[model samples]
Target chain A: MNIPADLKYTKKHEWARVEGDLVYVGITEYAQNSLGDIVFVELPSVGDIITSGEAFGVVESVKAASDIYSSLSGIVKEVNNELIDHPERINQNPYDSWMMAIEPSKASELEVLLDASAYEKLCLEEA
Target chain B: MKKTPLYQAHYDMGGKIIDFGGWALPVQYSGVLDEHNHVRNKAGLFDVSHMGEIMVRGTEASLYIQRLITNDISQIKDNQIVYTPMCYCDGGVVDDLLVYKFNDKKYLLVVNAANTEKDYLWMQENLKEEAEIQNISDEFAQIAIQGPKSETILQKLTRCQLEKLSFYSFQNNVNLDGIKALVSRTGYTGEDGFEIYVSPTEALELWRKLLEAGKKEEIVPAGLGARDILRFEAGLPLYGQEISQDISPLEARLGSFVKFDKGEFNGKEALLKQREQGVVRKLVGIEMIHRGIPRYNYRVQFNNKDIGFITTGNHSPALGKDIGLALIAREYAQIGNKIEVIIREKKSEAIIIQLPFLQKKYKK
Candidate 1:
């Protein structure tokens, strides 16, 4: 599990990369590895309203379909269109295949997200 | 959760373990799609020891078995196996199982691991004559080596001529490098393979031996996840999904094994009446025209009318398409019939297709 120190993480195994007012959302390495061979990924639309801890999209592997939780409440400003046709990118490089870029409505939620070290400890405890 | 003998072996090989029914089994090793293609091209080994095996032995074993299953067991000879469904009087299935005939005095039934207890109780409740029923699942361990290269790989260890074994047949007391076992030329995958059964005590050694022997053929240890997809693609009926306590074999398109002329059996009357009137529902294959995967228990409709639901569905790498098995009204089962598979809250476009997406490659 690669928990990069630069990004903030959630207990649900989602990561947030805060860039000014925008926070890029994608599942963490542990999440993608757990859901191997992702055959399909349903992306949240660009204009969709997303709430923290709520599922805005679905990520599907061969064996199961998992809900992708939003770590920050926001309006989806940009969607990763590449992942719709190539969901395997999430498995190949989860950090690079960011699912969405949200303009945060609740900026304080991003402050509550776990740091990389805390998330790393959480993964170890779960393991 | 129950653990099989190969539970530790799976962990040592980096297999991702999950709870399968009540058993702690590996759901995947490398990945589902990779293992699926490996079984299609090369050979893949599976730990199927969790499956329940029961023995019925007596002078009236054949007669007892005849009244239990829907298939004509009398039509099969010694050392052969017949696949069948045990049904309730209401025509609902008890379980779909494989009946292995050792002789007129003895028989072995391989049943679903989850339904073992229920199946045994059903047999005991329906016992009509003097016979012995034993749940021998714990005493034995089963491993299946499946694919095009399976025979060549297993041939390296066993001196028994693999070429001589016919499909749906088993040879007992076989020597696989000093390990006594029973090798059957039968498998759930729609590919050529052998399912070997051995004593539970000797199973781990045999598992390691076979993997080492099959190293040249690139045999990977597969899990239940791969097994499900292979069988699904092969158009085989699963116990809980395809046939269940609520679903009958007739509706599952397994009427071929239901012999109307084969003497009286458990559900013969109701099944016969069903045959006379024609089955009300049918299991058909459907492929998605919409982007979403038509998953299990998803509602299916025809012209906004709820007809049925998806029993099983997933993204198939072989077909490169999203597909599923749906149990729907008989009137809506026509091939090329445009239908809708309700994926989530939305109804997605799908078309009724033939049962098997691909032809089975069983050795003739």
Candidate 2:
């Protein structure tokens, strides 16, 4: 529910923080809350090519496991290794817990995402 | 819509409300794992008032129950409880319920929340003319205080000597802060606990009092989400998933609870025949050998042939891996057998293994 204004969101409930050519990717608060307490996070491997809308990893909770979709097309440059042991960090701070960093194939792909307000409205409509 | 007495408390505690079997209730609060671990290591409170309580009283109550149930009532003593499955004529389980004998003429049947109305109607239609039946779910609220610290916390609030009550035993008319309650040493989670049945109006006060007494242990308010994971970890069978009207008790591997040797019940003949002839299909545990999580209705493939389907599927919080219960052909249900779970179009390899992936700690 906490949609920060500067971030962009995907219909799949992933969020991207554009920092020039480097984009930080993680599941949104809505996704984290929906998934419940994250017990395990399967981070995308570094240097793996990720396609937009394609599932690259999995986020596991006690009750269910959800596929983590890539919001943008890119090659994974880094991942939050901290989440391997303490996946609950995503539940605590979804915005702060970046799952992976992708070096963009085309920075313009970010344009396809919904802004904070539009994403919030989309979530409301889905509910 | 059906509402529990603690609906307001659930809303106040930030519960994600959902409609389950016409009852609007909390699916999760805080988070599932947080509440789950709380109950495992510390303590957690659950509002299970949505569960049905049916009272059978009269001289013929015992005889009526004996005929309706598969378990032998003669084996259960007064103040004792037995968990058994009520079945249809074909040996398919209608529901798994707990039968508690309060006294010579009094008995309580605790059934799943979703099947309350259906179960009540079934009893009414099948009972002999001398029996009296009453659906008392609305009249009472049931609260479960489960965990290692559950007994000590509950003991502080009630006058009854909690130590005297052994597992599956109950004490009636126990005074709890002036209100009368029935405290039973029984719980779904494989833990030391008590399930209290009290007047709906007194539920909030009892919840508050227990919370106050369990303050040192940080007793959390758990929802159905935590309850599911806890029960799964304990390898307990869930009604809709592991057991259903289409699934027989023999197929579900719940033979221990099915008294085939006992006197005639609805499903006695079929179950006995199945037992004598040998069962063809059985429910078994499957752990993922690949990356994907197996889910319900997923096809279980072995040797390129469809053998079974997953019943209950989830990532085990305690095991840190994907696990599920599958009803597979008897030939494919052996331990260490290789199988494939079709998770979303792609097939993932899984290993046929024994259940309770994480060993249960029943708080001995």
Candidate 3:
């Protein structure tokens, strides 16, 4: 439910924090809460190229598995290797546990994503 | 979706609800890990009222039940429970159920909730004579208190001598706070536990009473998620996952319950032929040697050739490892054999181990 004013989000519940050329991405609190007790997180490699609106990885819970879609097309600069061993960190603090850092091909792509208030409204509708 | 008798109780306890086979049931009250660990170490209560209960009563009830199920009903004494699979004529499992024998004239069959109607129709179609069958699923509600401390928590309410109830046995007409009920020393979790069957009206009262009595001991209310993980760790076969209409009981490593020496049953001929000819595919345990969680329906391969698929897979909380049960070709189902589970189009290395990923602590 914590939607920071500075962050942008997608319909798939992924959040992006744009900083210069890099965007740190992770799932929102609503996503983690919906998918309870995350046991395993599949992350893309650091140098892997990912396309926008496509599934880059998977997040598995005790009951089912869900796909983690990329918000914008980018080259993964850094992947959070910590999530491989401790995936429950997302449940504790989803915004802080960023999955990967990507250098987006077009920074203007952020404008198409939902802002804090719009994203909050979307989450409310989903609930 | 159908709601159980304890649905309001679950809502009050902050249970996260989900749709499970058309039943609106709680998947967890607390988190899955906490609830699962509590059931392994301490006592955890579960509302299993969604399970179907059928009554077969008549002068020839015992003989009729013996002809339908795979287990030896004649060998079990009164008030004893026998676990067995009811199969079709082709040896494919119709459903796996527990037979609770009260006497020669009456017996109770507990079956999976999703397969209740199908099983009932099948039983009706095959009915010869003498025995009367009725669906009594809505008449009773079941609650399971599982763990090492289960008896300690439940004994505070009922005057029944739980110590006298051996494993796979039950006591009828037990006084549970002035309400007559049946208490069985059996559970799906691989722990010492008791499954109590009571009237639908008494379900909420009993659940609240048990929770209140075990509050000091930190007993939590678990849901279907923990129930699934516990059963998986115990290597118990689930109907849809382990044994289905497409999967035979013999291929599921449940041949011992087929009781071939006793007499003829529904699938006896096909099962006997299978036993004699040898099973082609076998269910085996697989542990991930690579960095991926094998999930249900994931393709399995041996040396790049597709052998089979994973039936049930998950991250085992008890063993702290990723494990799964896969039905693979018999040649690749050996212990220590190397294989790969295809997860999201990627093949991850895995090894075939024993059936149970964790050792069971059931009170035999």
Single-chain TM-score of chain A, each candidate:
0.97, 0.95, 0.96
lDDT by residue (B1-364, candidate 3, tens digit) is 9999999999999999999999889999888999999999999999999999999999989888888998899988899999999999999999999999999899999999999999999999988869999999999999999999999898888778898899999999888877778999999999999999999999999999899999988999999999999999899999988899989999999988889988879999988898999988999999999987888899999989999999999999999999999999988889999999999888899999987777878776
lDDT of 1 at A9: 93
Report lDDT (Cα) of residue A96, candidate 1.
94
What candidate 2 gets wrong by more than 4 Å, as runs, is A1-6, A19-22, A40-58, A67-89, A96-109, A116-127
Say which docking band candidate 2 falls in. medium
Task: Report iRMS values in order.
Answer: 0.6, 2.3, 0.8
Shift of residue B323 alpha carbon in model 3, Å: 0.3
Off by over 4 Å in 1: none
Compute the lDDT of residue B359 as modeled in candidate 1.
86
TM-score winner between 2 and 3, please give it.
3
Give each model's whole-structure lDDT: 0.92, 0.86, 0.92
Which residues of candidate 3, in runs, are more than 4 Å off?
A: none
Superposition error at A104 for model 3 (Å)? 1.4
lDDT of 3: 0.92
Model 1 DockQ (Cα-based): 0.84
Tens digits of per-residue lDDT for model 1, B178-228 = 899999999998999999999998899999999999998999999989999
* TM-score of each candidate's B chain against the true B chain: 0.99, 0.97, 0.99
Over the stretch B1-364, how does candidate 2's per-residue lDDT look in tens digits?
Answer: 8888888888887888888788888888877877888898889999899999999999888888887888878788899998889988888887889999987588999999989888999998888746799998888899999999998898888778888888888888999888789999889887789899999999888988888899998998888888887887677899988889888888887888887667778899888889988888899998999866677788999878999899878777667777889999898888999999987677889998877666766543
